[model samples]
Target: MPLADWLDRRTGWRSLAARARADLSRPVPRHVNALFALGTVAGTFLAVQVATGVLLLFHYRASADAAHGSLEALLSEVPSGWFVRSLHAWGAHLFVATLLLHMARVFVYGGYKRPRELTWILGSVLLLLGLGFAFTGSVLPWDQRAYWATTVGTRMAEAAPLVGEELLRLVRGGEEVGEATLGRMFALHVAVLPLALLPVLGAHLWLVRRLGVSTLEDADVEERVGHARLCEGGEPFFPHHVLQEAFVANLALGLLFLLAILAPAGLGPRADPLETPPGVRPEWYFLPVYQLQKYMPRSLLGIEGNTLGFLASIPPVLLLLALPFLDRSPARAPSRRKGAMALGLLVLGLGGALGVLGYLSNRTVQAFGRTFVFDDRGFPERAAGPATEPR
Candidate 1:
């Protein structure tokens, strides 16, 4: 306590403390609900990822030859190493999921309408960075699923319009996915992506702080400005908002630990170059595109079908980025903006459907009283067997 007094007197930490207190004590809209705490939940997961990653780094071997073995050792011999890795694994999924839900809430509530366009954009970028973190981190396991997934995943980049080959080479560090590819992914998962994520995340939080909570997305220009100003009526963020954030964050962390303990991350057999296993699927989030690519005809007007499929995905991403400008209506209510709401539903529904199709691809199954054979492209054809009752 005496050292704290001396440091504060000499180094002026009290001034910084005052600023922090001022920021925390600022008035925010009273209507800010649990949905508002999604950002805080995401921030909590980011901290967990960093903490767990540092622990993994101490035991992880970057080379392809040793990476899988190192993980095996960490899981079996190291204390609670499996739990730490599983936490990181499952946390990545939850982190991206919360970001998506957060963005979706903003979209539905029209939080991106006015004066907060930059915040939405920054949040979108953070979501992209979060995906990069997942993709690269998944590859670090260097096991069968990771190996083939990376192999196909990197090759899928060759579907890009013009610089496809260059992109492939750049990511692979050569013509194929091997040790060099593993090294590059390790760098991205550990260092490059994290560095890029922090600044954008900081700016997004700063904008939210300065603008206060955009409570009434349905409010028009004047009411919107007033709420942003924290004028007339609102509640202080210190105890009220902070307490809500803590509660939601505790639930999120509890769920994360539960998932980690219940279903720890799995490491399959070592990657085999000679034998490419059947029924290999990419991560869940990438399933839509994976299914889309499968449905693509081998050649679409002489251009590769997968290339066309890859190009098709660009429009949706651009739409998300330009949503604020496109939906320029003054009213923020979902009912007031039918077209945007319908389009959002269509996108989400299509993505879910495609993910389902991707999961069922390359397999045969019975459903709806008929036995259907699903091709690698997920096309269902009638089988020879008799129909069965729907379960």
Candidate 2:
């Protein structure tokens, strides 16, 4: 009776291990394709983000006055801090990309039907929380880019019709983006949002296990006969599906590392409320919405375009949440579900188009082998120089 063996038997350690092993070894649909691997890729980067974020918090200062200085110091003075920070930054991009792909896969494969509706709802919530992480993280550096980007970004919330003003105040922590705002964003990035994400993520994963993977071959049949009858045979989750997931995870990490090293995250000048950057852009993922707000006519039907756009954005989210109910057709085949497929395509196309337009609308100008930024109104502004504290 070794001490380790005694503990394993006395505690639930052995049974817990057995149960986990069994869970991983559960059967998966034979038609579960490579797209399913996107979930693993997203989860991998999420773990990286959390790990690097914790390391960063060791040196981070969350105040508006000190936040940019702290980041500059972290890059210059702390050993390996630059690389870790770069990993975390790039991991955010990778996580968002993979998560989108995962959701698209689920949508295209008709995986969000019947008993799995709650799983889809939970995942949709995670998507919004993921974007929250991106928005809050963008403001943490407290640099010129961060300050103006956040200032402009939060302004969109002020278009929420009746509650817009209150929403803007709630987000900014006051009348403007300053000390109070920085504190709120920092708390959200490091504590509040992460705490909220954990339980929802756990429930999503548990639902996947409880219901099993959806199959394409019998989608049409299952829609009518129910998913239980379609689960006739498949491969085990371990070794087979897990190996594919492992491969995708490794590929995602490799790409993240390459980007981190080649184009490491750079800190910019500290935020100055008195000065505005020439061209401030929100993170790429938010570019579509930003572009829409920027280019859309100021007035639509005598209403403010910003308010109209803000209200318009609400329906798509509601539509996604209501997808399982709306798409009640008992056929999962793409050809059979023409309306759903068409709508998915339109959404995807519009997002891609808006992203391109956002990039094109940026007012970056080149001169003397150096790039200079300008305000959206085309006024000349100072360049955000190298990642170093000014003497």
Choose the strongest candidate by lDDT: 1
Worst 10 residues of 1 by lDDT: 224-233
lDDT of 1 at 140: 92
Clashing pairs in 1: none
Candidate 1 C-alpha lDDT tens digits along 1-391? 9999999999899899999998888777766789989989999999999999999999999998999999999999999999999999999999989988999988888888777788888888898899899999989988889989888888888889899999899999999789999999999988899889889988998998887677664546636456646434566788877998999999999999999999998889987767798878899988887788877788878898879888887887888888888887767778888999999999999999998999888787876666888877677865837776657
Q: Estimated TM-score per prediction?
A: 0.93, 0.89
Query: At residue 157, what lDDT does model 2 achieve?
Result: 88
lDDT of each: 0.87, 0.84
Query: Which segments of model 2 are wrong by more than 4 Å?
Result: 217-220, 223-233, 300-302, 364-391
RMSD of each: 2.6, 5.5
Clashing residue pair totals per candidate (backbone < 3 A): 0, 3
At residue 104, give the lDDT of candidate 1.
91
